[model samples]
Target: MTTGRYLAAGLLAATALPSAASAGVTVTGVSGDPGFLTGRIIYTPGGIGGNAGTTSADLSIGRMKFTGFDTATAAALAFNTYCIDIFNYVQNGTFDLQTFTLGNAVKEEQLKALLSNTAGLIGGAATLGGKKDISAAIQLAVWEIVNESGNNGYSLSGGLFQVSATHGSAATNARALAQGYLNSLGGWSAQPGFNFSMLSAVSPANNQRQILFAPVPEPGTWALLIAGFGAVGGAMRRRTRTRLAYA
Candidate 1:
């Protein structure tokens, strides 16, 4: 019986351990004068016991001039090859983040193509190809657009750009993606071609200031813990009762 109890306790403890896949997303690329920058933007999901994750990777771009189209929407509409979707919604729009999986391969491909085209047309060389796994898609979306220029930041042709992605709590994979990029860059900083922000708001969920990684413990976890303690208490109480009876 003691061995069985110990086994249960061990299992419960194992469940509480953080997984390698849940480490969160990170961005490592170049920006301003110093160029090289790496940071994490933490994220927390809503609802009781929801999962959390963070974006540690940071990038910045500035003074970008475009010639292909005026706005991201125009570029999308005009160039179907890239297939850019435009909207103004903050929570549930085309870019709204519902989960961390973001298992939309088609959308990912579209994003890559669009960014590549934008870079080429803007006369900016593709120093680093922006590629992210399914887990880091939301962070991928943020890096695709944001303010970074000292005087002028990353805004759409005519208006501010806002978009988000959603995924399940089980799919926190930002760390893996960031490591992939960093490996590709040979541990070098300052791409010398792009600009970056000062670790400001990276996600609409206010990811710039905190670490949004890892899910909350389930109610079952607490229940199991309480039940385990109750068992131990019951065992002690029975021993006391027997001693009193003997006396």
Candidate 2:
């Protein structure tokens, strides 16, 4: 009986452990100074008890595909940080983000084709690109435009990254995404060529303002936890009652 009880307790503990999920966003050649550019955003959704949305390999990643990164490497962080800054940098040019209009596939394709060439990027030309595919196809496009236009602070070698955003209320998603990126920075105080000062709204100087990276709890995680706790408690109570009866 004692052995059975111990086994039950162990099972409960295992069931209560945290959970994770996967959400993928693919972008390429982001634009900015010191951009951690990429074509793929490497992320796995996760968190501790009561919170586990996702964790990214880099907060933002860039176009270059260098392998064998030690999670602690500055290059890794540079990639993730690029994802965070891409949005703000994209619109710095004379071209408005909304210029990517609906039903204008030709211009959108032109924009994509134009930005694909890292060697020949020119910003003024991006003013012609429309916003029809703004959210979906524009990540790399934005980086290309911004960099070509000299809109952001990213150096010539550092203007790209890939990042992702999953589902949630806009605010919750922002908070979690920003928090997730910040957390990914881990204990490192600096990210090589990347500038932390640019993140004025959520930097250490500003006490890390919150944005919605909506961290939804892992599916079935909460239910399993509750059931496991109840099971453990019930077993404990039953053992106590049994002892009392014998006494």
Candidate 3:
């Protein structure tokens, strides 16, 4: 078991931009416990289309074993750290926990209905030829609820998402569920979400756990991004003028 925390090199970047910020996940406080595995995973960001397509790629961190038994406080604190970072990057300020509410549980019936309505949704990948994959973006949202709510009810290992049916260990049953929906809809077509990233539990030793898919920021999020650039630029101009007057 590894114990030292190191940066997650080779992190996945759907698209890379010279100025684009790097992304990754690390879970703290829960260490060496079989129940929780949160480690740091980092990836570089670059793409041919610059940051535009990269923004479209959803952030999919692999499976988080949510059993709905969360104490809320610890989880909220942990999740908020990243939320604050993201908020600052987009909103130009620190994140307040009050702004984020705990989510409700997602029962099996509700999930089934969601899939039925969203059959065949898909999105283009950010890497390579911009490969298209089943983009059931909504499923990722539901996953978050299940995790936080502790609905350990149906899961990939044995629940609705069986590893064998998914065709590979590297995928979530949610992905398979998305693919199945596509098959019925005559294959993958344009969907609302893209660039979804997977989340995995990491051990303090830097070991990987099950993957959970996390949805990325939507276009509207970037639109809301508040920046200090304007203030800085104005201050710079004023300072320059003062220097010239003194000269």
Candidate 4:
């Protein structure tokens, strides 16, 4: 079978299996894709209270595409994800996918709000530049929500989370864009069809935790699918019974 076919078959099989505490996954860079943005970010030293005393470094942001095999069955699985932990870096190697919990209720709620509301801004950008801007902005917002302490509310220009001005207009504009999105969270309700799962690396404790976004079937839609499957199964059962009787 072709490599793509093998990957598809493996993914299908992997999804059928029960969820494991940690699945081995590998992450690599994605090039030539508008969905993934490449840009430099510089955080001010001691700017975020939670990440205090850490020196700033030039970092890139955007959606990460990863491909790996299931630990139990060796089935191939691939997906796009975003970083939630800015303190750690992503290495190109196998990492175990572990369930992540924010522990802080406020941070968890805010992150959910950001993911539910701003997903369209990233997905629906009309141009590559626009998409990159939104993608960077989302990453900034995520970092602020996850890492910032002392809770001055989420903001890129001020508060516990702040971006440095040395990285030029790209970094400046991204922070501003991110702040705009954070401001819109007030009175915003969680949107349907948006589901999020957090993944962390088990072996290397320092690897960044990532978030996966997926579209979920609505309750009504799932009911229809279940009914359709039942009808097909009944027809097959009836066919088998008739064939046995005739024989």
Cα lDDT of model 2 by residue, 111-217, tens digit: 22322221112122243121111111222232222223333332212323223344212112222332332233222232122101111221112111101111123
Which residue pairs of candidate 4 clash?
Answer: none
User: Candidate 1: minimum summed lDDT over ten consecutive residues — where?
Assistant: 3-12
Give the Cα-based TM-score of candidate 1 against the true structure: 0.18
Q: TM-score ranking from best to worst?
A: 4, 3, 1, 2
Per-residue alpha-carbon lDDT of model 4 for 180-223, expressed as tens digits?
A: 87777676556776544555555445444554454464332210
Question: Which residues of candidate 3, in runs, are more than 4 Å off?
Answer: 1-22, 28-186, 190-193, 200-247
* lDDT tens digits, residue span 171-201, model 1: 2343343233323332223222221111111
The number of the candidate with the highest TM-score is 4
Model 1: lDDT equals: 0.19
The reply for model 2, stretches above 4 Å from the true place, is 1-42, 47-51, 54-81, 84-247
Question: Each prediction's Cα RMSD?
Answer: 24.3, 24.8, 19.9, 16.2
Show where candidate 4 strays beyond 4 Å. 1-24, 28-54, 96-98, 218-247
CA-lDDT, candidates in order = 0.19, 0.19, 0.22, 0.44
